[model samples]
Target chain A: MHSKKVRIITVFAAFTCLLWIFGLGWTVKDYLIGAAHSAYSPPAADESAAQTNELKIIALGDSLTRGTGDIEGKGYVGYVTDQLKKEGLDVSLINLGIKGLTSERLAEQIKEKEIKRQIGQGDIILMTIGGNDLFLGGQTLTNITDDSISKLEEAYLSHLKAILADIRAVNTEATIYLLGLYDPFNEFPEGALTSKTVRGWNSKTMELLAEDSKAVFVPTYDLFQLNVNDYLFTDHFHPNEVGYRLMADRVAALITSGGGPR
Target chain B: MINLVQNEMTKLLGKRRFIIISVIILVLLSMFTYAQARQAETIKERLGTVDWRTELQQKIVDWQNRLSSAGQWREQLQIQIEQSQYYLDHDINPSEPGAPTFIRGFVENSAELFLPLLIMIIAVDLVSSERSMGTIKLLLTRPVSRFHILLSKYIALILSVSLVIFIFGLLSYIISAFMFGNQGWAAPVLTGFKVEGGELNISEVRLVSQWQYIIQQFGLAWFISLVVGTLSFMLSILMRSSAAGMGTMLACLIAGAILSNMVSSWTSAKYLFMVNLGLMNYVSGTAPPIEGMTLGFSLAVLAAWMLGSLVVSFAVFMRKDIY
Candidate 1:
């Protein structure tokens, strides 16, 4: 019979061996699953390579890219892809939009060791941000006087400029289409201060885009406001599936039109 | 002193009791080994025969396309691809003279889940079984000092538990190796898997022999099991009934597991035993629970708990009236 202390210690050792070192194939499985949860699980190797590059566009944004407000979750990204394919454009679309990410965060992700390979030179980049800036700052963003407006605008534009810089850095020849903020406040009944700031931010976005020849500004401001209640997700702010489809379709059109200066 | 301990143990583990327990331990170990083998079979079926070379290529392709696809995971896809490519490029598959895939599996699975359960089963009744049978009185009547007797019984129980566990380990290793052979002891390891803020990453991925992994796992499991065993044994002494001690400790163990699962949101619960069960997570470099606690924290918590239990157990044992 084993001494109780020694027996206990042995049990500990044995259990340790079992959990920590037992045939480790299981650990690999755990690792794989964990990796899959956050990272992309690429298509099976057997997947046929793209037949042609009629146009391979990856939409990178947040809820809008995800079709959050849409009934079917087919945000504009899907719509644009469908429209382009219908138009005989060979297009492959990848949507890498995480909810609740600010432009700062999205840029950080772009700089990751991982995103480098996903973006391609000559590929079109469709990006939508500023929703979170509105969500987090809300009415507080509107309180800026002319004196502070310039200061705040400088800060906001600097961040956007940094993000745009990253997109170019990652994909040098890529055309970056930055979607301005939609007017979710149009349907905001009576008067909400946050709604006014949403409009101000949209103007700011357009103003910022005017300085750059390459950064095309897609005006989603007028579109979502037309059917604020129906096109928006239940949250009443982010575009619903239909709204996203519209956004995606708009960007797809711009990608094809090769939009000239307004 | 020896007489008291012998009398206590003789009555506690009556000839029939001794045989039954020994059989039970052996049977449990055997069943556990059988189950482990079955688990390996299941993995083999799903993952396709454990050929790491093929698996690596498959992973690389999968990772490459994942980055190419858009689900807002483009960045992560890049990282995952690079890591997989690193392994494949270096030719460090699991079969390439390293810890077999199972040892890698053990490292992932060892934290907080299996180790505690084993300790719970083995040590919860180390003292209470005798007390529950009301044999403490008879033993106390002998001239042997209670402390001496308790110490000897403790030694014996520890020995039995250790042998049972070692055999359990050996049986599992043999059963798995029967199917895996050198695959059991050699395979490359990838330990950088992380899920923070819903983000994932991986690194290191060096090759270590499965045997070495087993040894490492053995050391880890021993430390964890010791913590659990000490705490449960103390509980057994305080409760004086096998069922009560076992039931309480089992509940506690289960609670720890459940708490660990949900504590990511609760955050503060990380200080509790439930969140600490998978203390190995810290060592494995998964983010610590509650944003800060490490393996060291969990160890300290277990140590404190054990020390507290010991104080209570000793105080009660040293002073309680035998009658």
Candidate 2:
């Protein structure tokens, strides 16, 4: 019995040593191979689900779409997604919004391959742009000027047109909803100048949309025009949670009513 | 010498130490697996209808922002960005909860801390217990030179350390795979980010299979465990009391872990063996506790300490009287 126990113990230790050596060998071999194997292409997505998703929302633009100001980290896009799910629609969202993306940068991003692929697969697309352009890209409010605003608006219009063209190039069937920017400086001393400039930008955006039957410009200027202080984030520029919800409610109503096809 | 080693190995193997350590490792692994499962569930619930692409993008940007302000965490954030970018670029969805990748992640994270502690537990009393138990005289009276006896014990300690780490890795993989699944070994992992002049140079990032990553991580982890075990072995020889040896080593290790984070600016702290023990961080492209501490530098520091310890231990064992 004593010898038998010793034999069993010997075998166990030997077996463990073998495994340890084996594991070490395997890792050493892999480390060498890994050094040589540098390029990696990720596996493809599930084909069946990828092709037949019921609803897909692709959002692009600046911090509002990125949910920067909202304490919950859920911008208008989150509210829209929740409302869509509540209404029993299967929703999958692709949001590609950088924090400080101007209209020009966004136009460039729209041409990128990843964004193009997402736009191609989207059933409903949403966007918010030109805020950084007209607001001097988060500069001090005193830096605003009527003449500079007009100059920024002209450049922003061409970029927004190019952006729309890029989206339409890849995706002709998706319902394109471009969200209009609101004036967070509506209660400030320069409120009138900013609102007027934002309205001019909106009018130009709406005119561009008029040329395309599938694209609709969702207006949010009126949404925050009254409760500007309440809707404004602590930064006094971006929209707070209540402001995003208001934007979401408007977009949700539009989608439920007629935007998303039955 | 070989016979002496074999005898020591037999004695070490026969002890209840192996059983206790294995049980402890198994219990901890199960707890980790359970917690991981719960976390995956919560993430799934929280994600709801958000697509993986948006989530990955958000995570990437968030890490980038964090990287800008956090000098200590740049390596981690850089790796996160690289991984997320790969997922986005290749159109591969981020890993689901309770997947093999998650298990691999857990193994990588715990190896540098838990694996070493387990090895320390077994090594702390290697020589001290024999002396305290009055077996040192019997050990000394043997025909073999005292050096052979001490060398045998040291070799046995190393073998046991390797065995424990092996068991921990294998058992962790098995248990986590059971909870999660055995898929995703083919998943691509990013590596090769290195720090140059205090800034991470992510230009050489490479993608290797998940299996490759686990194997490499295990190898590095084994090296770390070996270093830790040898340090404790020397302590056990010098202190002549298991508790004191183990306590001192543990305090130094814990203090090193803390000081590495808080005292990166203090140049003298760089020479601490504990500060240099995070060798895996260097292997994985994370910066060391102190600036300019490269993988080669840390390896050299550890090797010197290890060599110094072996010299001290052998000198003390050969000359000291067995009372």
Candidate 3:
């Protein structure tokens, strides 16, 4: 009986090792073949979609650009694309937004070759910056002095000018829409100060956009100005689906009203 | 004492159970390798025509942009970009798909869970099966002391644990190296990733050669297996049946893995023996299942449990009469 069990054990061990050898050999062979080939290439534009007047929308800037705080994971970018589709326009969006992105980082990002290339390829560019600068990178909203907001506004304007210049350098045709900030702490004690700071920043952004014909400052303060809680996500920073949908509607309206090439 | 250990070793080697368990682990590991390689193939297909250098640069920019924005997962993304930037600056491509570095990554990933379970299968039956087969009387009647006999069995258990781990590392290296080519051992890898107060503590991070990383990883894996093997060994001695020992040990291990994720905020969960088993997470610089679990704290907990089990195991075996 001991001998029989030993024989069974030996066979089982040998069989398993054989399976190991075979499986590993096959996988490694596949890996080798794969490593020799080109890993990825840009997708070719579909002729049918192009015939339907496909619009390439490049969304850039902060977490609002990346669509965080929404359980659906579809930030304003998704809603904008969906609304465009509803209007019988074929749309392809390239979102290059990062979380915690400041105006300075977005300025630097526009200089990257791939991002430059992506921006050049777009018919429209959507941006949400300066939120981090004023909010202090989502740290706190209660501590606000007019002096700090002015300093931030100065830095943000220079960065925004540089960003627009860089985008124009790459592609002069894409319409740039910089979204204005909403007062998330509308119910807080210093909410009034925050509202004043945001409006000051938006007016400055609008003044900068006036210099460029294709650049327009899209306002979002009115949408959440009254019912801030309903529009704001649970984080009290980013917009919920309802908020994103409102922004998307404004963007779609801009596009329909000569925001881009017809 | 040496002869008794030799006898124990032979008894272990001669059994079909040990071989069967080893084979099962081998099969599972190979399947994992196969799936990993398949995934690499699709990634390779997706990366068509883009130079890896350009891709790496693009990834760095993406990480930078992510870090600069106010959003969730900032710390984790920052660490990844830093690691990638290190590789970029050094001109070492650690992201080579299907490479040995990639395969070695899976070892550390699986070591915390799969490796320990494999070692448990060999250990849970060591003493209980002997008692169940009525062979304890025959062994105890010999001139050797009961302590020597149990000690020999324990040594044999350790030897088997070493063998299984050796096979796991060896087979993975041989098969992956053969396919991916024998490269990347000298490549530098970033280590010492740590978190504190729900934020990444960057001060602890460092860079080490891939070879050193592999050695430290295996050492940590072996240490974890020792704790697991010894715990199951104690259980095998206490329980009268091998099935009961194996079942209880398995349940405890699974529960510990699950509870580590769910009740990590529960301060007392840190004291559980299985909670301390993921010591590799600390060495690898990933977030621990629970916050504030340092390497020293886990090691001390494991050592105390090991010593306690050893004392209990010996006390019971020496006093209890053979059936």
TM-score of each: 0.56, 0.86, 0.65
How accurate locally is residue A224 in candidate 3, as Cα lDDT from 0 to 100? 91
Docking quality tier of model 2? acceptable
Q: Which portion of correct inter-chain contacts appears in model 2?
A: 0.27
Looking at model 3, give its docking quality level.
Answer: incorrect
Better structure of 1 and 2 per TM-score: 2
- DockQ ranking, best first: 2, 3, 1
> Per-prediction DockQ, in order?
0.05, 0.31, 0.07
Q: Candidate 3 local accuracy as lDDT? A: 0.73
Model 1 over residues B113-187: C-alpha lDDT tens digits? 565555566577767766677766876676767677667665544444444445445654554455445453533
lDDT (Cα, tens digit) per residue for candidate 2, span A1-262: 2545645555565565565556655544443344465566556554333455468888888889888789898899989999999999987666677777889998877775566766887889988888888777556357667677678878988898898888888888989888998888878787887778778889988998889998989999999989788987888888889999999999998998997845
For model 1, residues A1-262, the per-residue Cα lDDT tens digits are: 4356433444454454455434233433333333333232322332223344446465676666656656776677678777877877656555666666677777775675334445642266777887766555355344635555455556666778777777767666667788877767664443355455557777878787777677788888768656677777667777777677767777877877883111
lDDT of each: 0.58, 0.76, 0.73
Best by TM-score: 2
Candidate 2 achieves a global lDDT of 0.76
Candidate 1: residue A72 lDDT (0-100): 70
List where candidate 2 sits over 4 angstroms from the true fold.
A1-53, A108-112, A136-140, B41-55, B61-79, B90-103, B197-207, B262-264, B267-269
